[model samples]
Target chain A: MPELLSDAFEQVQRDVDAAFDAFLPVPQDTRARLVEAMRYAVIGGGKRVRPLLVCATAKLFGVDRDAAVAAGCAVEAIHAYSLIHDDLPCMDDDDLRHGKPTLHKVYDEATAVLAGDCLHALAFDILTMPGTSSDPFVRAELVATLARASGHEGMAGGQMMDIVSDEEEYDLRQVTRLQQLKTGALLAASVEMGAVLGKVPPEGRTHLRAYARDIGLAFQIADDLLDVEGDEAKAGKALRKDEGQGKQTFVTLMGRDKARAQAKMLVDQAGEHLASYGNDAQVLVELAHFVVKRDH
Target chain B: MPELLSDAFEQVQRDVDAAFDAFLPVPQDTRARLVEAMRYAVIGGGKRVRPLLVCATAKLFGVDRDAAVAAGCAVEAIHAYSLIHDDLPCMDDDDLRHGKPTLHKVYDEATAVLAGDCLHALAFDILTMPGTSSDPFVRAELVATLARASGHEGMAGGQMMDIVSDEEEYDLRQVTRLQQLKTGALLAASVEMGAVLGKVPPEGRTHLRAYARDIGLAFQIADDLLDVEGDEAKAGKALRKDEGQGKQTFVTLMGRDKARAQAKMLVDQAGEHLASYGNDAQVLVELAHFVVKRDH
Candidate 1:
């Protein structure tokens, strides 16, 4: 990605953070614990990849940047909620995330669970705020899209598969299918949501989806690579923890080198989707690269 | 509270069971175990109160039954998910529900957690199906409304309060506030969604909100009353368990007689909201009575 585009992405991230920080319901004693948990989970620093997709996809289609920001933040809320719950004792049981304590580890398990639940609901609430979407029909479509991407056939199902797939052997195809649903589903939705915001042409929408899927897979592969490399500080959580847990991962199914090669190939395919847009997708191009190159 | 209306409510209950039974995705292996747990949690018979609200609201607005059935199903899915998660080992730790084994007790804790997560997502997925809502804007609104009602400001928050309120004394006002958000918010949404579906006037919508709110409180109050005099066979889970857990219940805060009197008052207020609709709202009237008078 170009330096200017990188700077622009950072600005968007800042704005998204500011919007969420400002708009969340005030601190009331009745819900003080829940409110605190939500704040911690949401504001805890991360790469903000999903929000970037929403911003970049909207910009690619020449829509108002302001319009995409709220929706973008909403998607991030869903992403944050998933992470919080995924790290819970009854779920993945991780003690750390993004180089910080997991929500459950910081607050109590009950608070973490409630925080996740609230965050998921808040995502839809933000997207449906009065005057957020230009048309009610469009707003509905966005809501439906986000819900499908986050729900049973999407993220939740993938999580179920991931849990069950642990200790089981699987080929690349099966692993890819699992990752697509678990990780790629929301990424695809993030890009598609931007297209919906801009009302992109059918062809453009299709290409954006193709781009999201390719990069989403690449992102997971890179994550596996980082885990194998023992990049504990950068990668966060316990390093190589997947192997110890017998979780079926790209690095476990495919050799580490092969996983890296596959990630490169996926990124290349994602880039091919942007050829149609020429230089308009500079941020997305950089994002694809960042997804693979980052140690964390 | 007419006899004919009560019969109509019973028919809706049957429809709810059939819908959940038919719509559950077939489980595969471990997933099957998890899905089965979800099915057991949802399929266990109840009053189907939320679904009834959806149907009744839709009918009030003159929307086609087919168009509104998805929304009805979606609300129940959410309600079921809340129950499953709430009954987990870390949460309520209940071993029974609807006179059967609870999800976590029947399945493993991890599976129970995932089942709840999937079911929660499933509710969103069902609501957002391609053709579920003809008007996309309405679909978005429904999604947003449900999220709010189900999230921090509504169900989740209510639960958090319930947990905290224990070990502390609370007056009737505080109890009312807690119950309003817990059960009342979603109940109000059920009526509002129906009105939204039927394209009712703003005044009519307000009336539905008032009706739902009043009945929702009455419903909870009656529930507390039931715990005081309930049988295990009729009430599903253990009765008086709330007091055993040191829960701050309405009956505990106020004498049982006072609680019953308050419930009756709320039921009367709920009935007044439907006075404008005459016989058209007979089912809702009966529902209000049923909520206050039911033993289980």
Candidate 2:
């Protein structure tokens, strides 16, 4: 990994951890348990990939670092809440995430549900705060983008497709479409929101959009590969369950070698989209490479 | 019921149904089930009380009817989503709502969870749309207000209290604090957001806030009375569950007749807060009276 990208990831992790810690203070009341569950779900976990994407993209246009990190926190909150609900008994029924017991395993299922819900609301609340951006237009746009990406037409819709995948046989195209909505939408929103914070007009974001799209697909293909062959200890959660369920994925459809090649090709293409930004785009370029190459 | 208040409720129900129908369209994909569940939860159910409150308050300041309805739809989305999750097997464990099977009972638990999440996101999505407000500040404020009301410190926190009430012996004051967060927050937010849409400054909303607070408490007291004495067929849900669980409620803490008298007193107080608006506040006053008087 490049030093710049590694340092950026460390910075994002620190900032996001601090932000969530300050945002959620366990009240001295019966509601304390709910807040604790929410804190457990969000703090000190994951790679902070979404935050890194937001900061990296925002940096290109010289957006404020704090504002970028705030937006990243909002995106990560959505991601964290989705994971909580997805790990429930009715969904993946997983007991481990980030190498710890999933929320429902640690707390009851009811707490897990409420914590996820509270985190979901907290995402929009964070974006609307003046700390995110002084301009109301920027804040409103961020909320709109994140809301659209996380809702019926985006992550939740893709999750529905995944649930039905057990009973239905899907082709590569179908799987791709499903993953696109399930994962790609939020990834794209991260970059788009960064651009919005920088006041970049819609017409000026074609290359950034293309870059996000390429990396989003590459990221998923790599994930499918990881599930098929990665070490469970390093992955920090259950792997190989995708195959056990007989779910079709990029790895199952394209073979490991082809999927690896495709991801590498996509990463390369993603880097090409940032060519006009010169040296300022170096971190983003390295982040794309890391997306496919990371062990986790 | 007064004709003015009854007519307002009818108008709100029709407009909110139409708005949700237009906002959510089932796609020709596996996502159709999720969308269907979302539509089912939002349309053709409940009293549309929140929407009526929004339109009524917005009318006080002469805000645009279409824009007021759009904001009302956003609030209704949040209310509907909360009911879906609250009815889940892991939460209240109910099988019925609004005279129909709960989302989990009709579909599946995973579908219900996803549907609730999608609607939660859709609430913010609707608020950010051009149809809700032309001004960016209003849109941002709407998101902020709704998000705060629905999240950890408000509705979710109240729910956490309710869940623990089964094990804890809560006094009247504790129960009031719990209900204030659980039910009062969202109801108050309905009136606040309506005032926000009409550009009523926060200082100008003191009387309106008082009115919301009074009616919010009155509404819950009435709910408790209904649980003790109302018809299950009319309520469209299981009654007497509070006593079944040995939970302390307004009726249990304040006795049935005293609770009924208190609700009526609060309703009258709520009407007094609207006296400054004269005829314009007539429907709101009637709505407050209806809050404690309705059988369901």
Candidate 3:
């Protein structure tokens, strides 16, 4: 059954990659560098955990495949854009991503900036396009959710906090809030968009939203744990970066054993949020466990 | 009357400023710096020319004043965000904007970058919100147009060309193309969004679009001339920036007299594009003439 879950994840990942490719082809002319950097950053990479949540949730509701794929790719675009910006010299200053030179290093800093900017625009562009949904209301909902998740009250706000968080100390509660805004917003939006695509009633989405929040917190704790214990080669990026950068991640504040226990407990609780759906929620339950279990 | 046009411009500027203030208030906590930077970048500055275009065009179709103002604010957000990024140390490295210290100089590089980024997201956030338009179709159209005009093929792509055009050496046609994308896209979108909000039929938009394109080009040409001959106090920023930077501009390449003549001719042609609408487009016509004749 775990193997079957792996199979489902891979299928969604491949489908999402195809969607990215179809929407974004490498430009052969003047704007090629920005286009190529965007394609390079988005394609052929990472765990695609957000896309999996979107696709799995959509499947539970029998939403159209194309709608699910479009939503998945929109979330993935936001994730990729954030990574590119995070790698900038003025930001995290990292030079490696997925074991390759970061976008700013591979391309010039200016191109890196524009590529990230364009990709952010592209996420909304893809979601609102006709392929995503026939109804404009649905498209607006997707656009609104994605924009809210990606913007000041969400990921960017979290990043601002992290920039200053290094200089000023914060308590566990503050750190948790930062993590929720920085990481949880997009993760929650991925599941939220799936329900949107499925036309889930406003009142009907409570369980799914609860499920997303639990796994989102668990996902961050898992990332913190992996940073401390993961193999660099398997992670496809730097590991154990918190201490070097003065970042007070969950592992640093809570210790590895406690963080690990907390992640597992959250995953179990996330699975329980789907009690109303019973067997229909099996993939989501597996995903909750997989989120904490995965090394990368 | 030119005097009447000037009075109308001030009116819309005040209204747009009020809209921006409503959407972006200064935050009080950890993220205060970013929110402050956004407010500073957006408020109390510029000619408010782009917002004028949105309001004037909407006036032609009698589009709701609130919708027009919302769309105007969205385009202004894109403009403010672009100015912030352009003033980055890696880009234009500007020290002054609107006679005030630039965002990066005021609040460090990282905060400036994120503030600009968040403002970009805030534009989409505002456009898709309920207050922007009651019809979701109108909201989606506004979002799609703004995203396209702001992203790779539009402002950002134009910016990428501007960064390298100094080294690569482009002709007048290339420069015009770059300026169209870099500066023209958002201006054109302002008018287009006004029409969209008014729900103009596809064919009905042709003249408005042609008018927008003509004025957009004229606006850039006027800007080039201002960089050569504008008063520092009136312009509220550095003048002669093009010459000090050694970049070839319309004034530099074509000579001031010729560029001035070209701008005047464009303004006339822009007015002619509104011939079908006659008196209804008087504001747009006056704005075109102002583009060529204004001191700043």
Candidate 4:
């Protein structure tokens, strides 16, 4: 990784961890277990890619650092909650995530469910906090954006498509739609929310939106590639399960080499969309390349 | 029930149902099952107490009826989601809710979990929409209030306490605290968000807060009492489970007679707090009376 992009990732990880730690203090009561489970799930995992995306995008408009970090945390909270719920027995039933036992494996299923729920609410809670942004319009828009991205029409809806993927054979277009909703929506929202925090109006965000859209698809394609080829030890979760489940993916539909080429193509296109910002978007351009290249 | 409160409940039920029906239109794809589960959980069940609370409280400040109903729908979304999750096999493992088979029973566990999560996101989505409130501050505040009320320190935290209640012998104080977080927080938020939509400042909401607090406890006490004595057919769910699980409750701690008397006293006190609003608060006062007096 380029030093600038690597430094950005490291800084976001530290900031997001500190923010979640400060945000969730375990009570000295029976609720302690719930908070503990929530902390366990949120405090110390994931690539912090969403936060980095938010911070990087927000940096384009000179948005406040703390406010950007707070927004990033809100998006991460949604991401974390979804992972917890997705790993439940009734869902993906995964026992591993980020190289550790999943939340439900570490805690009971009920605790996992409640903790996921608490984290879901925490996302909105963080967004509406004055620390996120003093501007009510910004805060409201942030909430609306994240809510729509994570709700039925977006991430959750995509997840539903995934759940049914096992029972039905989906073509490339259907798979693209599903991945767009499931994974692409949140990624796009991360960029959009950063732009929102920067007070960039909807019309001024055309390039940023394009950049996000391209990277979102590139990221998912890369994920499909990684699932088929990456090491579980490095990925920190089970891989190659899609093939085992006979689920069609970017790799399956397009073949591994073609999918790899497509991911790279999308990433390059994503960087091109940021060309208007010139050198100011270097880190974003690097980040786009990293998305397709990342092994995990 | 008094005509005023009964009418309020009837109106809220119709309005909330209509709002949910409109808000959640099933898609024309794989996502349909998930939306179906969400609609099944939300559209046609429950007493709509939270919506009534929001509308009644908003009425005190002459807040727009449609906006209040939107806010009410937001709160109801949270309530419905909680019930859906609480019925999951790894949670309460219930097979029924609102006299219907639980969401997981009717669909599947995965659908129920996803539906619950989707509804959770829908709550914030609704609150931030233009129809909920045109003022950005109001929208932001509504999101914050409901998020806090439903998150770890509120409803989910209360649920955690309830999950552990079977093992721990809780006293009245502990039980009260648990109930306050679980049931009281969201109920209080209903009134608080209503006042928020009406642009009532925090300092100006003391009486309203007190009214919510009193009725919140009264409502729970009535629930515990009903759990012990009410028929399952009337209650629309499995009753007496608290006793079966050996959990501590108002009835278990205070005994049935004292619990009933205390509920009545709290209801009377709740009405007193709304006395300042006089005739305008009559519906709220009747609702308070109905809290302890209802059979279900």
- Each model's DockQ? 0.69, 0.96, 0.77, 0.96
Docking class of 4: high
lDDT of 1 at B73: 81
Error of 3 at A167 (Å): 2.9
Q: Which tens-of-lDDT digit does each residue in B1-296 have in candidate 4?
A: 87887788988999999999999999999999999999998898999999999999998899999999999999999999999999899999998788999999889999999999999999999999998889999999999999999999899999999999888889999999999999999999999998998899999999999999999999999999988889999888999898789898999888988998999999889889888999999988888888887887
Cα error, residue A277 of model 1, in Å, equals 0.9
Candidate 2 lDDT by residue in tens digits, B1-296 = 88898999999999999999999998999999999999999999999889899999999999999999999999999999999999998999998788898899999999999999999999999999988999999999999999999999899899999999998999999999999999999999999999999999999999999999999999999999999898988888888999999999999999998998999999999999999999999989999999998987
Which pairs clash in the backbone of model 4? none
What Cα-based lDDT does every candidate model obtain? Answer: 0.81, 0.94, 0.87, 0.93
Which residue pairs overlap in candidate 3's backbone? none
| Candidate number 3, chain A TM-score | 0.96
Model 3: share of native contacts present? 0.64
Q: Highest lDDT among the candidates is held by which one?
A: 2
lDDT of 1 by residue, B29-77 (tens): 3356666766777775667888888897788767877657778888888
Q: How far out, in Å, is residue A107 in model 2?
A: 0.6
- Mark the 10 consecutive residues where model 3 chain A has the least summed lDDT: A25-34
- Candidate 2 vs candidate 3, TM-score winner: 2
Q: Could you give candidate 4's per-residue lDDT for residues A1-296 as a string of tens digits?
A: 99998998899999999999999998999899999998998788888999989999999999999999999999999999999999998998999999999988888999999999999999999999998999999999999999999999999999999999999999999999999999999999999999999999999999999999899999999999999889999999999899999999999999988998898898889899998999999989999999988887
Q: Which ten residues in a row have the lowest lDDT in candidate 3 chain B?
A: B24-33
